[model samples]
Target: MIPIALAPASPPERSAWRRHRFLLLRRSSQLAVLALFLLGPWAGLWWVKGNLASSLSFGVLPLTDPFVLAQSLAAQHWAEATALIGAALVLAFYGLLVGRAYCGWVCPVNAVTDAAGWLRRRFKLNAGSAPPRGLRYALLAAVLLAAAITGLPVWESVNPVTLTQRALIFGGSVAWAAVVAVFLFDLAVAPRGWCGHVCPMGAAYSLIGSKPLLRVSAAHRSRCNDCGDCYAVCPEPQILVAPLKGKAGSGPLIQARECSACGRCVDVCSTEVFQFTHRFDHRRD
Candidate 1:
């Protein structure tokens, strides 16, 4: 269990807003993306159409979730031309720029899980033993294998991300149930379990952007005071160790694909030890 004392204490030298700037920005981004989809149904503004499985922006630009496209192909279904184009667009953007950034910035479900994590930490709740991190990769493979055998995008049936968005927009009982299950699982069964150790969608994104150029860097690792604030807040804290400690000459850049490029570490660090940077930046002070 994480102690409440590990929560970030705003250093007198840093304003509270400054300390939480990235966190605020991430929240705003997540809400803005959701608003784009909600606007069509809520207010009849069709700037973006369709769900995360496939979307059209302004009736021109197409964006498809590549993992879903892979499932279609694995099920022996020929993808539409638009789907191919959309998948390519998503792959290029995530593969070259920000790895798994979707998990941090755009995924609506992240907010739900983040809330559960906060409540767990706030109450000093003891989480059940966490499943192996590697379980996610195996689940990713299993999702694909299931798709092949079942001839369906099976994961979508119970995917909390999609269900959470649906519950907010459509208000279905099953959708709300799935969302609650994810929240309860994280709050009681595991801390940050759904995304960090079990989500195949996250696993797919990690592989898609395995070598992304954009990364978080421990540029000022020398200033870190072992305050534990960053680790307490980060969703995938394991990725921070080597870079923050300079272990085995790991350099300053956080190169782990599992890292969602979430800037919680940068936001919570009183010493300002972390920053967003390109992976090529190796400078340390």
Candidate 2:
């Protein structure tokens, strides 16, 4: 077991940029996407309009949240052709990449939860028991069920991801409070409670991108020092067990649907035990 004291440390031999390259790239991706949304409202640039729920890019490209589309369909709300196109685009994008990549690279709430995680490690705070991982799938089902029964897309009203994006681009509301609540919950109550165990949208994405080309491989598992830094930083550490420990006939590819493909494992491993690769790359050392 990696002591909590050593959990946050990355491979020190690598240059600082090498150690944190993927992390920095993810942050840049998240912030850059957010800035595009903010440009129209804050600076009147009008590059991307609407919110993450649905948006028009350059008034030509359409992008919609497929989960929201599902909810709308469940509610018997007829969607426009553009909405359909948008949803298809999103589905196709995530179909090629890992689904929860949205959580790691695009969701604004990710920034909030990530900050909470960093603080937890910095303070060595013990995370209490988290809710079952299966709970999110139930919540996903319930969200659709509520949409069907109540004739409303109920989750959207309270979804932290959309709320955070809306609040950041459009000024202020309960988004800050909602985002803060998620941060606090992850920090004090559960280590990775929200995105890892409770977000319905994440559940929806996991299903959509259940099989993706992109994956993190434990190709060099033989070099692992058992320092636990990869487990310490992974958003879905449970997926690492089989690949990292290397059971007979088990491939090095992390094939789990829940993996966010966040690359924190790759970033923190002292021995370069993990790397981003296609799902087919199972070569083990």
TM-score of each: 0.95, 0.94
Query: Model 1: how large is the Cα RMSD against the reference?
Result: 5.6
Candidate 2: stretches off by over 4 Å: 1-12
**Candidate 1 lDDT, tens digit per residue, 34-78?**
899999999999999998889999999999999999989988899
The digit string of per-residue lDDT tens for model 2 on 5-122 reads 5464554598888789998999999999999988987899999998889999998999999999999999999999999999999999998766568878888888888898899899
Worst 10 residues of 1 by lDDT: 3-12
RMSD of each: 5.6, 5.2
lDDT of every predicted structure (CA atoms): 0.91, 0.89
Q: In order, how many clashes per candidate?
A: 0, 0
